[model samples]
Target: MAETNATILIPDISGFTEFMTTTELSHSSRAIHMLIDAMLNAIGEEYEVSEIEGDAVLLIKKGPAPSKKEILGICLKIFNAFHSQRMWMQQYTICPCGACKAIINLTLKFIVHYGPLVELKVGRFVKQSGMEMIVAHRLLKNSIDSHEYLLMSEKLLKQVNDSTETADMVWGNAFEEYASIGKVGYHFALLNEARKNVPAPQAPQSYYRKDSTPYLQTTIAANFLDVYMVIMNIPGRAEWMPGLQKVEQDMPDICIGSLHHCLFENHQSTISPLLMISSDEEINYAESCRIEEMNISLVYEFVFKKVDEKSCHFSVRFMNAAELPIPEETRGILLENMQRMAEKLKLFCEK
Candidate 1:
């Protein structure tokens, strides 16, 4: 068995707990999965995904180790990507559940170690195992007071010290005790500077005008959050929405750029959510799509108001994005379909 040198990197999420009710638990799981995917997609081709271990993603690189500057650069990229996605989730969410609102509190940290490992092939899977692998995993449980930082093993630090790119870098020391390895020391750097460089996510574009009126309006006998959740349930739209045969979501979580194809009775349209705004008094969401058959672009706006604990007011408006005149017959057909769908939506939410 040949010993191969490898560098192990793990990006672990913090503030995730299993203490929640059914509703919170479900939303929390989806939110975490979305964040993890965001980090994975931001990684470069130099690293290979070894495994996804719950809240942490294990990545491995073969042969030569990455320099300290390169590792820090990658860490910064991961933090920026994670925070950008987190901001998007907080801003675009219409759900008021505890799990959805708590996404802002979630944090991410990294663990990096460079050492030798023996690869064991099981059927088709390649598993990297050795003492260095254990040390990398153990460093995840160090005495770092803050939740967000980068921890590098002392061996990796020594290898990095041989390079000349080390300047203006501040590091702290931390140690973790292992039953078999006695005590292992590592260097840590807080990610506050990296996080500060990430710009806030831009707000979604709005297509509403002051004179615009809702094409269809209805009041539902349910809470505002309940109505919002029911509408955001893209898969369940076929049940209450008229003429919608099915919905194919392009991504697991719905954000501003998410696209989903809707199969209707006669035609299909690609819908993308453009805006989602929620406040104490009301919640507003908007979706835009091009009606190729009519050669017109349309924006669908949903406004929900909390009238009381048991009931709320919901209205749907259609905006012409192209600012072109719409035929009376075409407008009439749209209103008729919306009216029927509104009735079914109320029934579904209230029941």
Candidate 2:
């Protein structure tokens, strides 16, 4: 056994237990792997990956502890990358698999600690065994009381003496007990709260229609074609539209008379007749879906306009076929959903 001083960090996907139990095993497993890959990518060169424990990753750095600046940056990079991947998955993933679509429900959390570790090689795997490793893993179960948060052991904090940069970014708990590391003290940081503390990227500019009609328009800072590709992919609405499990077009080539159908999660369905309004000229399309049972139809319009050299204005317009008046509250909900979809799409391409 080789003894070494090391810092252990476990960034786990919280709530994965309930997620795996409820979602289809195949899809859930694939989504978990993808998310795991994303987290590993976020870690990059600074930390070493010792092992993966289900939804949690075991990262160890064999040396002196990282400064507050290093730890803070690493945590934020993981946090930001987690959401960035989720946002991209939510916006453009066309899998239609239940678990793939439900990724937005999962959140990432971290447990960081520093101590002496004994390294033992078990075949091809390098296992870390020591009191600190036990303490780091035990720190995973805590009274942090928040789903999206990072917990750091007092041991690690003591190693990073100068953290004037991140001094205001954390709060502490004086003591907690562990079987191996008794009376352990630590600090917890809500990742969302950390985001507010850090300087964030600028959000897109939005302008919703002031009229009672439900519509949302936003200028996203990306090439118009990047945004247009996402809007025009009809079969890919599985990403942005909730409750839609799968979409299929009967004809191989979508012409003026192509028929398409959408199967929703609630067992309700919609059959739409595609209109070849502007297939390739510019990103604009209109289609109508019928809810036969309700004796009503929804008209969906997608339009994209170039705003400038770097940005474009994209809008989603929905209206009832019978020209029925929409309830104020219902309109608000629709507008909110549309805006969220736009924002997700923006994040997907912009990032």
RMSD in Å for all candidates? 3.3, 16.1
Model 1: runs farther than 4 Å from truth?
Answer: 18-27, 91-99, 162-164, 199-203, 212-217, 248-253, 260-263, 266-270, 289-297, 307-309
lDDT of 2 at 217: 79
**For this target, which candidate reaches the highest TM-score against the unseen true structure?**
1
lDDT of each: 0.82, 0.71
Model 2, span 292-340: residue lDDT tens: 5455566667676777657877777777666676566755765675676
Candidate 2: residue 305 lDDT (0-100): 70
Q: In lDDT terms, how accurate is model 2?
A: 0.71
> Candidate 1: TM-score?
0.83
Cα lDDT, model 1, residue 248? 91
Give the TM-score of each candidate. 0.83, 0.57
Stretches > 4 Å off in candidate 2: 95-97, 179-181, 195-351
Residue 265 in candidate 1 has what lDDT? 92
Q: Across residues 1-351, which tens digit of lDDT does each residue of candidate 1 receive? A: 568888899999887654134337778888888888889988967689988988888999887888898888787788888999999888777566778888877888999999999888889988888999999988888889889998988888777643454355568887888989888889888877767778789876544453455457788999987898888777789988888999898777666767888888977777887777788778888888766776767778888899999899999877777777778898787778778878999999999
Model 1, residue pairs in steric clash: none
